[model samples]
Target chain A: MLKIDNLSVKYQDGNQVLRGLSLSIENGETVGLIGANGAGKSTLLMTLVGILLPLEGTIEIDGLLQDKKNLRELRERIGVVFQNPDDQLFMSSVYDDIAFGLRNYGMSEENIKHKIDYIMKELGVEKLQNMSSHKLSGGEKRIIAIATILVMEPSVIVFDEPSSFLDPKTRRRLIHLLRNVPMTKLIATHDLDMALELCDRVIVLKDGQVYAQGNAKDILTNQKLLEEAGLELPFCLQRIEL
Target chain B: MSEIKKSINRISNLEELTYRDTVIHRLPPVIKLLMTVIFLVTVISFGSEQVSGLFPFLLYPVLLMTVAEIPMRPLLTRLLIALPFTLFAGLSNMFFSKEAAMMLGGIIITKGMLVFVSILIKTILSVMSVLILVSTTSMNDLLYAMLYLHIPTIIVLQIMMTFRYLSVLAGEISVMYHAYILRAPREKGIKLIDMGPFLGQLIIRSFDRADRIYHAMKCRGFEGGVIFSEHKKVRTTHWLGLMIVSVVLLILRFVNLSELIGQLVIG
Candidate 1:
């Protein structure tokens, strides 16, 4: 379980990106964080991962309060897929990229090999293991990026924006991937359809504040509240025309 | 995401250089580095009077750079920057040497030219060898080679860290330069005074970025010492390539083919 309390972040420019936001995710739960541009979604994720420091707040992952000293272990336990896949995929080969995190954690060579192969196979991306990252298509790049973090075997997975730039087919595949991926997930995205399809619960952020939170269907189908928060209900939320 | 894309572009560009299936490109960097040192030593040991002898030694670096596909024009341009300083020293010799002490066309021409040539060749070979090494091997591999060559771990780590931050710093500098271009009038070249402030801002931002990177690396469990997870076996072809190059360079140091060709051309 991950719990964030009264979290706030402000840049040197004095722009507050996250405003006293509080949220929680239970074990094995899939939570979607919805917000428009500049709504502090990415900042919130970064703060949770310890990439960005919060001005005021407490983050507890699995009953242990988060602090700078134990940040390495915390980050190890929480696999974060950044909004941009390219920033994190820094190795020459796909195999090397996937094994990067594991190696950083000091995993044995044999175990690194076993885990990398196993994760790639599990993700249905074994064929791409030798392919250069630059050559991969957009959808393939996204999948490979996720695989890089997933191979680290974190207990919690946080995706900054998984559905961006993907075609409908790839988006559907990603939703399916997320649904089947074991471990707790906190996904921050603007795609309401993805949220409705994959998240068990939803948290709405507006101007860096949590505007609403509830079961996925209930929050997603509420046209009035979503509209006020600069969000629109997913097409799936609409009743049949007939 | 755009930032990430830029980094991916940087990484891809780095890998493309090493894709050649050549024996020289595959040699362990330490061996290649040692050989380059030897070449430099031989080139430097030539007597100041023997300009003809040094010409043969010139073939060593020239062939390497040509085979390595390093464009000579730019390399020469960089080497030429040092010529002005050498000319300053050579000019003093020309003006201040006593008539009895200086041989006609011997002391001023031979000794001065040789010293200048020696420095120029050393500078070019050093830079060219580094360029060749980096072009043919990944930065991580080069770092490993440095470690194997018994370089200080702290220095290697510093180099690796500096490299990691270089891209970040480059991006920041590019952004600042772009902003300056956008706001400043094109007719007046960037004001000389503005450069100071611009660079000052860049250094401050770079330090902040470095701090962030350090934290990020720490969070990702980066220990002080670098770890190469997999060990690759050294192949025989890598050794053979080194031996061949070394032999050819050694053979050329004594040859007067350049003088013979010059005479033939003159005839």
Candidate 2:
């Protein structure tokens, strides 16, 4: 339901980050974006979210927000989980962090509390409601970050390195949590296994261009293409026949 | 820098140690902030020469600070840090005093002390009020309170964005500083002149970082202000409690019993 066409971005100093990169996703589809460090994955995501205006190109969400005039309406419709929970969460308590979005939307107090409870329960993070961000474990912090966006109940969810620092078990749990989510998801990560296991489609981003895009099975089985794009194959995917 | 980090850790823990189960923490930050303003306005409304009148007014902020469990020493230390500024401004009165007031035991005092004390008390009270506000409320909560109070959207966005960018800038600068420290071995610290390039680079990178952050927000469909679906409306009793505290403070400010006692004790 989201379409980005020939998007480009440059810093004020005129350092180009994203060079005419185009990407799209359907409703309820989990699309994996793989790139090396500084490949402009984050830049592309930010451009789509309206956090950064593109230097060129058009972004359209079908049957969704069409223009900048209804930005508040549009923002409320998309959820972004930032790479660092520390930066995303600026609240004193976990409950407050999750409730921050609701407060921004000016939701009624009862509804705010209800949404927080429901999201926390779904994430199995009910016990972290009163805990400070300083006291949380890295895994718990990741979950809390997810709750911050999930509580908003946006139509599209964009996650930037959701499993970056998580441990294996925590990463698995997180993968499960992400799998259960029913929104259009655009995940940018270097984790090939996660991309293979959790995404229906995989797109390789190399040097600010889309190098390859196809079904998960087709993309995961191509060893040479994965290596050329600086990505390794998942062992499980490698064991399967093409 | 390490010392600062250690002290931050120490102070945050110490602050956590002396928690009081008071109603103040439960009050909405905007209401508490307004009450502090009202208390200060009442203090300023009284004649500056009326030292006794201002003495009792001290109890409002003092009692609140004490009962609210705000660490008095730190609050006072912060106040003392800014004390010299007020003192310098007040020192001007020493040179030009046209009026002298009657003093006890054939001693005479100028209107300067009266004005000076008013300024001093006013400064202490206001600083304490601010300390207590931050102590009781989180910075993020205060920002949210400001938003809910109908503060202009752009200002709120600026505040939030500034906070987000501060650490990003700090981290970049800190890394540069660390690299310099490692390479340049010296018994003495790095000179201010040595920091010039680092500072300049940081400034350049920070603006670029802000641009990136803006794009990040936009990609998530953030057009202007970030919005969410859940918010809890504050309860009525919370409002009632705030009004009660403010009204009581208002009543106490007018009745100049403290001033009477100070005058009687001196006379």
- Candidate lDDT values, in order: 0.74, 0.73
> Model 2, range A135-235, lDDT digits (tens) per residue?
58889999998888888888889899989889999999999999999998989988878888999998888888888999977887798988998877876
Candidate 1's docking class is acceptable
Error of 2 at B233 (Å): 8.5
**Per-residue lDDT of B18-134 in model 1, one digit per residue for the tens?**
555566666676676667766766666665445566566655656766676655665555456656776676556545542442354464344554555555555555556555666
Per-candidate clashes, comma-separated: 0, 24
Q: For model 1, what is the C-alpha lDDT against the true structure? A: 0.74
The number of the candidate with the highest DockQ is 1
Model 1 collision count: 0
Residue B264, candidate 2: Cα error in Å is 7.6
> In lDDT terms, which candidate is top?
1
